[model samples]
Target: MLIILLLVVFMIGTFFGFMFIKNTIAHWLVGGISFLLLAGSVTMLTMHIRDNWGMKEVTTSTTHQIYTAGDKSAPYGMMIKAEIGKNTDNYVFVYRNNEKSEKADTNFKPDEKHISEAVKKSATYKLVDDTKATVTTKTTRCVWSSDFYKLLFSVGGEQNELVKQNSVVSVPKDTWLVLTQDQVKKLSQEAPAMQKQMEAQLKADPQKAAQLAALQKSNPTEYAKMQVKQIKQLLGITE
Candidate 1:
């Protein structure tokens, strides 16, 4: 819509410039400038629309902590801002670790209930201490954020234990941490090879894959269903 408007405006500008400018060189220059602007406007508008519609927003929170080597010293921690409303029913958590980054498999229908269950059952504290954290209910969603260091202090001596048990500790940045239903559908269509690649990688590196495998083993019923769904999608067996 904006592109069409810009094109129309450019055409009018070009027509006026050609009619008013007696100099051939000035007229041609003005016309060329208007055309270039029109092309640029169209390109920008197309990209804006594609980004807004093609990609779903996945809410991500990053918690950073600077831990001392051995001492339970006070570590500085901060939660990255959460994106308010990007996904229909899912959010992703992303963070950095060991100079390398990793992303978890996408989650679906991650509402307040799901998140509460995940926090209680999943050892996210092993990654970051969130005991003092509380969820606040928004008009359509729940939100929570905490200082990483404060969480650690709340954990006391059990911080290392939590770290050893959590996969959230090493999640990657800028990777799709979670996928909404629409985003998942699009990903399934466009990146069928992704699942196969992940499977092959897991097979080749059992130790490194243990983290995610542990998650699946601990929740076999849920994880199994997820795997089957992904496999069906990857094999073009959409139902």
Candidate 2:
């Protein structure tokens, strides 16, 4: 829509060129501004489609899958398949932006130690003993200034909240983190102390084992969801 309007404006400006040949300055000014508008409109539209991320329905029962990028140039893909009460990443988030992130150029890669410390100092994630972090939304946005694109991904929801249940990997920036279901399995491995207890509980309860088998047969992703609820119940983690 906007592009069409810009094209129309460009045409009107071209018509101005013929009308104002006598006033060369007027023609030059209108023509230059129109060209910029056309270019800007094209750039914005391209970025919008490139940066779009939205929820998609799950269609598989597989426990995990890895999605590779179409190519390195368009590097990005991972979507966590989690149930809000089920699967989650036992993790803390440390964030960093580009050189212009701060008023002064820090030109430094974010250190995990510093990011972890910041998470600990925060009132929200401070006391979260459980490993899994609930992440809500994920968006990959490319910030274009003069020429280079500064791309970044944002993970939302409180630190303790289950990481986003859907796959919304940050594009090109940190695409590797959210690419596959392996992340959830990795997170489950983090709190082995708690998992050991859950494992023993499941072992003793043959009925649960049978049920889990049946559930897994039907849908592995859904099975993970059920297991997550079971573990939280055992650990007494609140919503």
Candidate 3:
């Protein structure tokens, strides 16, 4: 409606300005209208670009099931989970907190120059236009970040990471997994990535899989207890 009003105003200004070139009052009125229309259009276009193309901190969370391949020992693989729209009983949203620390003895530079690399190493994700996806959060970041970690961003600013003395490796909490709505949809569709990662791990460490299988087969009663405990933990049922 606002856009339509602007269009009408522009047409009226164009028509009147051309219709009365001899009248000083009418000329000033049309000039003022033209200036306002130009300013409003530029402002609106800037906002539109920022809203659709800019990066947003998606902190709203929803529950979804994870594929652990019956591994009762692994805790929740992700710190938070989300679903597509209103359907909560679906595949878990995948995210990993990757941290790499450098040894104190090693020649390292903890400067702003390396923040871009650090941010890249922190997560694996892609960005997309917000209009391509429909996920939204009613609450702002201040309300949505409760009990959740703040994902840092240094698009053009230098960010400092936490460091500990004498610790050989210092993996600071320098980054978080934040994605736009369309990017999240792109990621959610790649559910097979997690499966492949697990398969690769099993292939690399066959002994671990064999040990789990043997444990499950050798003691069915104990295995049942472990399974029960895992289910309770995943379900957030204390009793």
Best by TM-score: 3
| RMSD of every prediction | 22.7, 17.9, 19.7
Better of 1 and 3 by TM-score: 3
Put down candidate 3 lDDT per residue, 168-202, tens digits, no spaces: 11111111122234543554565457557757987
lDDT for each of the candidates?
Answer: 0.41, 0.40, 0.37
lDDT of 2 at 189: 65
The superposed Cα distance between candidate 1 and the true structure at residue 168, in angstroms, equals 12
Off by over 4 Å in 2: 1-190, 228-239
Residue 114 lDDT in candidate 2: 59
Using lDDT as the measure, the top candidate is: 1
Kindly list the per-residue Cα lDDT of model 1 for residues 141-170, writing each as its tens digit.
122123432232222332222111122332
TM-score of candidate 1 on Cα atoms, chains taken together: 0.24
Alpha carbon lDDT at 62, candidate 1: 38
**Candidate with more favorable, higher lDDT: 2 or 3:** 2
Better of 1 and 2 by lDDT: 1
